[model samples]
Target: MRSGPTAEPHGDTAEGDTAGRAGALRPRRRLLVLASTFPARPDDGVPAFVLDLARHEAEEFDTVVLTPRVPGAAADEVVDGVRVVRYPYFPRRFEDLADGAILDNLRARRSRVLQVPALLAAQYLAVRRAVRTGGPDVVHAHWTVPQALVATLAAPRVPMVVTTHGGDVYALRAAPLVQLKRWVLRRAAHVTTVNGEMRERLTAWGVPESGTSVVPMGVEPGPAAAARARTARVPGRIVAVGRLVEKKGFAVLLDALRRIDDVPWEVVVVGDGPLRAGLGRRAAGLPVTFAGQLGKDEVLDALASATVVAMPSVPASNGDQEGLPVTLLEAAAVGAAVVASDLPGIRDVVHHDVSGLLVPPGDVDALAAALRRALTDRDGRERWQAGAGRAAEPYTGDRIGARYRAVLRAAAGQHPD
Candidate 1:
């Protein structure tokens, strides 16, 4: 990618610089990322994939992240070499939109619906501020519904690449909201989704096939996971990790465990969310341990040491489904034999009887049977684990980062949206 001329925010050579300034000293390009989910602190337990991607963008450009401000988070801070700017929407006491996730938060609390207008207005102002003050050459918005829409509203002339994570496409499907999504997508210079199924959805929306691509977030099999992989795997040890949300299918997982109680398998559930207490109450007597949100290394180690990993994800009641669960990829990286739902988005990782066993979403009996096979059938489990490891090779941080860098470089060269 060609580096743009070195220009600081508020300097004479602004976005409208003349040819003379374009000849100035060359420097890294600027990437302004808009996201709704980010870790407040280094160990805040929120998903760090956005931060990981920003770290990658920082390798080739000056990456800046603009996200919603949550309680106890800095308004501006640097995380892993990426500049993060958090914008406040509501009162500090009442700002609950980015608590866990925008969709999950709304599903958990009905009163939070009142905070939508404030959030939209604040995000627009933030994007406008980021564009004017940061002088970003291109914008990368993580979700289409509000982030991309807000970027277009805030800086219509700025080129943007919209990334649809999940809820933005599946949950926000009301007639009016669908039009709004299409409006933002049409204005985007390039659109990227985490899975092929979503790319097909984009094609169905009349988005040009040439302008869309599937680029998923990645996981690195670092020393922690590698070291754990060398350790002896525990027998009948099932591990599952993700937010305890309805889409995560923790309730269904508990039901599956109920049927498999005759087996000698034990489960360790990692992560936390609104449904934690309810899930706890439901898993009354099973040999289950609710290990609330661990660090990335810990989660990876647990996955690496597990005999099997379970991801019985189901579509949430509000129509929200995962674009592709990062947990699925992480499990693959650690070579854990997996039993996951046969969702379209997940097919990229979980190949039935190949990479891992696949059960229909929300099917407790099928999930139970798959788990039973993984626990008892050693040869098949090893074969599937090896297949998962091979499937995960192409999704490492280095490869995904290069792909994203290429897309951003292309968008940066395009005319403003």
Candidate 2:
């Protein structure tokens, strides 16, 4: 690891294992990251886990993030030493297909489907540009379908590592897409998914198990995060963070909150999505606050302050489900007690009745009972929080970042120090 201080705010204030990696300057290999989703800024609450991963990678690579363009965001810029290149996929006004996620955009407005061909073509062009200009040693494609497909086409000679977040492996299950996904994986030097469930899915699709890995986009566990959990834990506060969408199971969370009338709990839902308006209506007279989307610092603050974190994720109608939601990781990092669905991804990290309580995805009674137990039982909450912090240790940003960095370097025929 480079020895020196990090000019970065997040992991900069490194501690424990990462504290030794500070105050260093060195030129390193170049890395090209192709993705459908990325933060417009370092702070904006656009799910910055990708950027967080990139920031850590920047320590080892001259990282360049190429993502679809959004209105008001610059086409090219640098944030926290990492270069960001936003490629125009559709018309400036109609470029909403990439942000808020492609699947969500299509689910919200079917007309957005018209932009898919344009996005794919434009992304391929962007990858070509990145290959010629950045001359990256290896390519890191964030999603399987379009990003990996385009990367394989655009940078055919470059060794690439493909990382599949939840949607690509779980949602895009049509026979043609499944075949296409398998085809794409063949080109990757190595494949990584967020959880073992997705790894199993990828292998069943014919991806060799030996060549694949499970690496969740991780959280930065620092003093600030720990303090948030410690401070916000009083008087019973429940925080749920995720896009207000079907797969997130926020509707189920609301129902569970309603059922727990016996507990004196206040709810804070921190995200905005297509279902926000309807979800707001459903919340009705509950002690809930729609905090909407929050920036990274604010989100960490919220997570830190939360006594209990709820991740009521369920399988969407399209087969998309939680492949280890980042919210769960962040909550664990911040030392918050979690009440989550008993999904495979969640099952891997959250030990049922150990790190947190687990209930069936849509079972209102079970969810309510779990939430109520968390709120009323102080000893259990503390124990769960302690266990959560331990569970989250492997997923610390510095560790996961180094793991991914090693993978990318190995793909490029190099080795980590």
Candidate 3:
């Protein structure tokens, strides 16, 4: 947690730094963040980072968020002290379409050929409007396409930073529409990834190493786990949080649960996604309870009430993975024991047998055995809970907010007036 060299605003040192690197800038700055999918209609967790940024950034910078409205979602206003402007977007019905069949499928593969132009125009228009209204000093866009393209096109004179989350970096690069995303990245003043793995991936894909920053999504202080520790019986309740996707390794967790027939456990998975029904079928006859999706408070409540939080995350067959599930950090913050897969981003957050237990990726028996051990060993659980809670201290939203502030300062320095 050593803070990097203190940002030096102005002069040659500021010429190529991220806005967050410019500490000596004018006291207050205006920032506009463009995200493809932000929290909309209260159930969305996609823009959780934006919400955290706005909350903490408001202390110093004037902030506004421009997010696309998924067809049926409500148009926006301010939520939790952040100014949210949702723009019109086409309904995406085939997001879950399987790879097969028809001329429509072929058209859909080339669909981005059409979708990209429309998205760029809409996002550029929205950014232009925000500039007129707020006179933002920098434009920060999340995800590769549209945000990067729109920000570049609409606010070329304004310094801009683009962040590449999992999808854009891992899935979209080689896609048919990748050239546009590549163009957008090339034009961005700075590019960031949530973890080191992504930074390396993007660099390999041709983004300059100097322009990339690794800034993970931060965790918030959750309910204390010690309060729950007072109770004697544990391993009775288990919790899992994340969208119900193949990459999350939900099926593997189910397989683990089936192997441990003697352990009396009840699982509460707290998120929704396309695989819900498929997972529901796979979980048949197990002591599982799918909570569908829950609010942040609700998910934390589940973690606070649980004995062990299992995060059996694994890199998907197609190479998709997590950038450190904030859920694990939240569980640790609340004093719950963590048992997760040892994978790229996860390895950065979880030290096997130190902060939490780490099992091999996709090993159901290992996951189940770890869970059983964590449940029965009160002393071991207490040790991990205390140590893990302390380990999570640096990841809290407040701490992360401060880190992002530093990054923005650096990014702004790259293009000082």
Candidate 4:
């Protein structure tokens, strides 16, 4: 079968030719991407997930993105060929009996609480804008909760696809939330997830099997990626990517680092989050160095410079988990051997003893041993690196983009009976 985005290849030639020629002769499908989280700054990786789809699909489609605008986001702009429109939100505020703003001693917590309504309103406004703009063949939502809810409202008049990344479904399975999620899933023309676990969860939650699809996330190797891989020299540098959070298991990795006393490898942690200060404190007086947050090129360079990539992910306290971290794919695509925790999403990305090695989640000794083996054994490292690079091929933006095109086309009711 012809892959990528080709015209209705199996349908009637005359009818097919008309739409195909129309699409190719001028512009292709108009795609609207919906998401609650998008890149607000240069160093952010959140939008890269959605952007990869837009960039690859742009080959056969024109793309527009609707994202929630916070205080920091640009109202409108184009990034990497994707047109982004951000909408502002006004939050509900609580007031005391005196009609003054309820005084909360922990001002930060109060502000965080107040921001939820605004975020939700912005997402709803994004959906209204997409529906009003009126050109996309389909609306693709990046997460299940707010975006899915918005898509559900917009789908009665237009086709829509919902993608469940980690938090969308997993983090909000409680009473009313679960009910709401079910309603949205029922309304979606199609649903997609990057891992088996998420697919299973959605199916169990009452989403029809036919409507659910498993399309792993993908990466686009930069021009220098292959050349850098060919000339990789182990600097005894160990690297970890992703936001500094418990599920990422930076603390567990820190404990593992303490166990490997004799190894001279220097640990370089990239990405930032709420847990940075705590994680930094945990690594105090050790060989660990926090690179804070870094840009895409710098992260790739960090992976290239490392002897091994350590991803000690675990299920978070709230049951939130990784949904195939793109960092793992990026590291592997650049030919770096990886040692990842054997968690659901992480395991899906890093195969044990194949692309890379897997160790028990939160086991300091096991992680340390895997790190040591990756760093010390040259032949083992080479085998793992080659396997990692090959494994990364399926997750590349081109391959993954093809899946998106297929799913969206099918979801849009464009396919013939």
Candidate 5:
């Protein structure tokens, strides 16, 4: 059976395709992708990088995604030609485990941690059923905690590729979790990390160095059409985009903005999360607009018209940090000046004073100074924008997608011709 561009109900069944003119059905390798967060609908404001990666991999394989189900999402659907199957782990109302932000949800309520067992059990059973039915050549599991653990338990015989985004590597450092991660890493055919620091951490945690690769998430900044000329941009308009979580440092940005009131600037915060109400209260009497959770086009439009893109990311109390923020890369790709915190993952994307200004993390005064400079120095901003565009060249979706495809194929024991 060959998978085609059609939606199928969630079950242990496959659609048969007709033979081609050559009187033979083309055999495509099957891939089962395990992830926690996915777009619930077409217009959902969730990050679409995993969806994009599956779409690109679909070019060379029959890709199927297994993600946690939300209230309004379809049980099964074909998105961008990739088949998606959402598994229900809890009641519609109680399905907060993988909803908006996993880390934030757990941090907001310690009781939410009790949901982890059921979530992992449901995901493992679903993956087992999918593997038995779909018979994928390889299982691609995103995040180490639940997905990789589920894959290791459900489809131990299949070659598995595990990818860690950040939180799983940094935040979940308890002894038992670390031991579980080591067990999963030992079983995986290969492991991929979004940044070099994560790979080093994995090795430090006893994962073999030879089994890991660094593959950062990729973005295709379509064309520079949305990029505005420096003189055409708003003089003092600042834009910040990301989930309104503790790690995003929006509260700190608010403090920095308060200090920089001498400048004629306004900030647009473009995401929604558990901290929205509190962040709004913090932004009171400040020129900050809470444009809650915008679509991609609207975000690009906001970036294009801004004087600077501010991403003051800091380590959350639980040790959660970024894994190379896509927003910073998008800002660079769109020729927007950037002011961000100096951290491991972010440093890989933004070079201090070259592509963008990097300030000490959690320092409101330093962030204020950097933003003031980016807002006032037109020539410097132009130079940084040019350098940023150049720095963003290696991260185009096509290039990164091809690299990932090669790794996946190799892991599945199929080498490219």
Candidate 6:
């Protein structure tokens, strides 16, 4: 497909001036991104990895994001230098599919599954319009199932790259969904998974190893100010950052907190989800603080002041688990001592007894012991804090962005300038 004129509206210019500038400057290639979850506003704390990647890509390409609109979010707006278009899939009140967790929502109320058809249809139409009007050189789809399927149907001529962020490949294992995922993977120019284990999983699902790459979701390395803040960490303070979901293992963390009641420590839980009420009730009489859903800066502050960061993630009953938790990387970046579950992605980040401590998933006794050790041992905590910065260096935005840019350029058959 031939690249068309840019869809971006220009400020009024003299007729000759417009033509002169147009001829003088080479236009940036258009990149259309398909993502399910995106921040509706600047300060919105929705998973910002997609938004972060889009912003970095915007530096090289004219990036435009097409995502599903939620209840209170703006339908279309430019955020952080990237143009975002949110499409209405259902009635505003009923547009809950993309709100918190799609699978969790569907599992909680079976009626939410009815929104799937409209969600897919609206996304497909919006993507088709973007391809026809904006003439993207490449389409980068964030999920394997619905977003990639929508891209395949809507912009078949456009070169596409599909990236799976764990849940799509792991949890959605029904025969039909698996077949649909395989179909999308087969058609894409390239595919990416957040971790090596996920790449292996995709290979088993019929995707060729040569076409897939492991590109973990990246984070902005903590700033110098945040690093300075980490120097004065509050003693005996443990911080856990993630959605209050089953897979996050917040309930298990609460049990561990209860086990270590004699220790002079406080727990801060950052994030909100369906399990908030139940988890809060369970943490009753404990020194747990629920700082629900803060902005990125606030999260960084929490990490900076944290003596230890706990990520007690476990596999959920529905086979849902983390690909890699960005908060762990962020905490490490801030020089916080981390104690995480010994799972695939978490293990990849936290080297046992090196950068951070690792405990067996769902083992309250082991988790409590790890927390006690991190909180009480000064020299060991110092070693973990020092090594965390080195461990987090690979996940910085600059390194990850370069990798993604290279892949996107290769898929589009463009030589780097």
Candidate whose lDDT is highest: 1
**TM-score for model 5?**
0.92
lDDT of 2 at 263: 64
RMSD of each: 5.5, 4.2, 6.8, 6.2, 5.6, 5.6
Ten-residue stretch with the least lDDT total in model 5: 14-23
In order, the Cα lDDT scores of the candidates are 0.84, 0.83, 0.70, 0.73, 0.82, 0.83
Give me the displacement of residue 212 in model 4, in angstroms. 0.9
Clashes of each: 0, 10, 21, 1, 0, 0
lDDT of 6 by residue, 1-417 (tens): 233343232223232234334424556677899998777666567778899888777655678999998766777778876888888889887679888678877877799999999999999889888888889999999988689988999899999999888789889888888888999898999999888898898889889999998998887874624654655688889999998888999999999888886679999999998898899899899889999998887788888889999999999988889898888888888888999999888888799888999999999999999999999999999899888877888998867876776688678776533
**Which residue ranges in model 5 land beyond 4 Å of their true spot?**
1-26, 223-232
Poorly placed runs, candidate 1 (over 4 Å): 1-25, 227-232, 414-417
> lDDT value for candidate 3?
0.70
lDDT of 4 by residue, 386-405 (tens): 98888887787767876787
Q: Native-vs-model 6 lDDT?
A: 0.83
Residues 1-417 of candidate 2: C-alpha lDDT, one tens digit per residue:
122333222344333123123213234567888888887765778987788899888876678898999867888898887788898877787779988788988999999999999999999998998888768888999988789999999999999999999889888878898889899997799999998888988888888998999988988878446557456455688889989889999999998788876668898999999999999999999989999999877777787777788899999999999888887888888878899999988987899878999998899889999988888888998899899989999998888987887687689776423
Q: Write the per-residue lDDT of candidate 5 for residues 1-417, one digit (tens) a residue.
A: 145443222212121111121113236678899898788886567887788888877766789999998768899999886899999887777778888667788887778887888898999889989988889989889888788888998899999999899888888777887898999998898999988998998889778999898988777767444444433577799999999999999999999988886679999999998899999999899888999987766677788888899999999888889988878777888888899999887888789888889999999999999999999998889888888888888888766766676678788886533
Q: Give the TM-score of candidate 4.
A: 0.87
Residue 114 displacement in candidate 1 (angstroms): 1.7
lDDT tens per residue, model 1, 145-226:
7889989999988889999988888887788988888888988999999999888988898888899999999887674366
Clashing pairs in 1: none
TM-score for each candidate, following the candidate numbering: 0.92, 0.92, 0.81, 0.87, 0.92, 0.92
Q: Considering lDDT, which of the candidate structures 4 and 5 is the better prediction for this target? A: 5
Model 6 / residue 286 / CA error / Å: 0.6
Candidate 6 regions with alpha-carbon error over 4 angstroms: 1-26, 222-231
